[model samples]
Target chain A: MSDSTPSTPRGSADPFVPAELYTQVQQFYARQMGLLDDGFPDAWADTFTEDAVFQEASRLDEPLRGRDAIRDSSRARKKRLEAEEIDFRHWLGMLDVRPQADGSLHARSYALAMRTRRGGELDIFASVVCHDRLVSVEGAWQVAERDLHHDGSGRD
Target chain B: MSDSTPSTPRGSADPFVPAELYTQVQQFYARQMGLLDDGFPDAWADTFTEDAVFQEASRLDEPLRGRDAIRDSSRARKKRLEAEEIDFRHWLGMLDVRPQADGSLHARSYALAMRTRRGGELDIFASVVCHDRLVSVEGAWQVAERDLHHDGSGRD
Candidate 1:
């Protein structure tokens, strides 16, 4: 998400979207693609708050917390897919955003990600939904938080 | 990635990080974990700009554009995953945000995801990156655009 400063009511009326802001968001997400796809553990660490309460818990598993811990997890996961250097391609569509009373906003986006390995017959895909928060920082808009949703539920 | 606004500064006087901005970022990323684990897509759409761009590209590839198109991509992906009623879990972590000129931001994050099938060693883990933009909408922050990086290039 584009991380930037908040505008006063006196600014753009009707809560219209600005091209500049969209550009910023594009850039931010682009960088994230780099960190995740490039297998850069340290890069992911720069995405959240220092004391961020990062936990990815499943319905049947415990949660993973903290930036450093998350980095380790990312490294491990990347290593597994590193064989033949499989590439994960995400196709996100169907998004809707709404404003909140507390000046916070919420958004839901639908995504389809495909992972294709080099010279392989496997090209796996998954469906996902994303939830996130945006907060103004240092005069820019940035992703204050983010979460991912995998569609449909059934036991393994 | 969160595309909503939380209160923070444009730049921090401190060398690396600032206190308020740090906490806001933490809250933002943590907020996402809760939303996705719960699988709430309806609320997720409200986080974006009305005229937003959603893309899926390599950090090095040309970006796909627009919210409506992104939606189509999402639907296609969801159908594919829901097959056989598998339960998928998205592991989101390793967030990094960088301030930019024009009051925007670029960020990097990592995800380790898996699915539980009817019977098997579950599914493969996923590694993904995202690009997002932020803008001031109605005096608050909201996502202007979002891009998906799945090529595993990490070329930001």
Candidate 2:
């Protein structure tokens, strides 16, 4: 650990947020992605809080609320992919994590979800920006709310 | 700064990399994105090293080598976008930054590029996975090499 504070050329007011926390959040998301891609939807759902909210851009009118709803939707999606024999990979990048005054975190990142049909070529199925509000639960950061903002959506 | 090192659930060997360093790298990339989006092609080009290698998945046949080449390419791109009157925005997310043995950094993230044609609706132009090799030059992180992997490129 270096004692030096991070240099913020853009003059960020909150320059004192611990870097380790950011790393932890990055790792948390990585684990979530891994679980989702590796066919472990149940495990992935466990990463969220009991009262977490997950919203998809296309279905903003009906956001999934609570862990059960999130898990059910994930399982249904996974089942559909399996039934269709589609191989999907979700890749995430450009994570911007900020500390909130409430001791939680406001995190955002870009996501690319690609799918490949059996013996068919791969195609980008979705490109969206994920905005998340994460809270620490039992010394671990759990996503409390996630909102997906679809890029190129004129509404956004 | 907390003396306690972050607990690594996945057994990351380099858990001790300073959070400040990670924050600096994130900020560096954010600044680069801001410059490009704000139409500062020259300043954006300055984010790369003199001997940097920039490769795009769609243009692997002609990788841009050196700062001059990078700047020229960026300027040309800006000109083309302007000539066509296309409004473009690139968003990056889910950054995974790791330390290299040589004190550089190996980073990966997802990128979403959107473009809106004149009198047309916005659409996703490109979705890519960015693999970057970054180095700290003069206490600031610079892109030493960037290899973009387009997700869902059947070739991948």
Query: What are the root-mean-square deviations of the candidates from the true structure over C-alphas?
Result: 15.6, 10.9
In model 2, the Cα lDDT at residue A44 comes to 74
Give the per-residue lDDT of model 2 (tens digit) for A18-37: 65776777767765775665
Best by lDDT: 2
| Each model's lDDT | 0.51, 0.75
Deviation in Å, model 2, residue A36 alpha carbon: 3.3
iRMSD per prediction, in order: 13.8, 8.6
lDDT of 2 by residue, B1-156 (tens): 011322222433234346676567668778898888777899998999999999886656888899999898889888998999888887776666778889899887667778888999977755566889998899878899999865444343
Q: In TM-score terms, which candidate is top?
A: 2
Error of 1 at B36 (Å): 19
**How displaced is residue A55 in candidate 1, in Å?**
5.3
Measured by TM-score, how close is model 2 to the native structure?
A: 0.60
- Weakest lDDT window of 10 consecutive positions for candidate 2 chain B: B1-10
lDDT of 1 by residue, A10-110 (tens): 11222423334433444555576567777776776666444444432233154455566666777887888886588765544333344556654454455
Fnat, one value per model? 0.06, 0.29
